[model samples]
Target: MAHPLIDELTDSSFDELISTAEVPVLVDFWAEWCGPCKAIAPILEEIADEHNGQLKIAKVDVDSNQKLALRHQVMSIPTLILFQGGEATKRLVGAKSKRDLLADLAEVISN
Candidate 1:
């Protein structure tokens, strides 16, 4: 089962979503033309479903949302930023495996 993912975000909604989320958030900075971004989409969906109540998976398109992408210093596509308490705690650039993502996410959530 795959959980629903927040596939787009704006500056207006970013604060409310990240700052006010009850659990940790994984924000994926992606673009329509990025192969790696497309590759990781399903994996992200799966993780979201698996950690339904514990975390959130959000996707931001760099091409459409340039401001938001710049704010996060996203120089690369498919960058995953882990947010806790409205602050970015971990940043993973490029595509990563599910096992690595799980381990990294677990480390943050546990702290």
Candidate 2:
């Protein structure tokens, strides 16, 4: 299981968690078979801890949650989508460095 800061979103809780979140929610779409997803897990964990109040981290298993993935149009693993006010604002595909991730999320924290 992931840390409390990181929420594992399932079909049942996805809409509620993301829609009701006060801060920007970063949803990582991944699968257990994805190496890149596993590689970036720690970075997301760190980000969750570092930006506790400013942001939130969530994960969706594309395998088990196919409908969610299809609706989001996630064609790749480790796709990170930033949700705010129940809408997706940014999409980052593939693995990225912590610095890059932070740079991408600067707007969320700043605004």
Best by lDDT: 2
- Compute the lDDT of residue 12 as modeled in candidate 2: 86
In model 2, how large is the Cα lDDT of residue 50? Answer: 84
- Candidate 2 per-residue lDDT, tens place, 1-111, comes to 768888889888999998899998999999999999999999999989888999999999999999999999999999999999999999999998998889999997753
Model 1 has an lDDT value of: 0.83
Query: Per-candidate TM vs. native?
Result: 0.89, 0.95
Candidate 1 Cα deviation (angstroms), residue 41: 0.4
User: What are the per-residue Cα lDDT tens digits for candidate 1 across 1-111?
Assistant: 323455467766788899888888889999889999989998898887777778888878788788999999999989999998999999999898988878878864432
How many clashes does the backbone of model 2 have? 0
Q: Candidate 1: lDDT of 4?
A: 44
Best model number under TM-score: 2
Q: Candidate 1 at 23: error in angstroms?
A: 0.1
Question: Quick one: RMSD of model 1?
Answer: 2.6
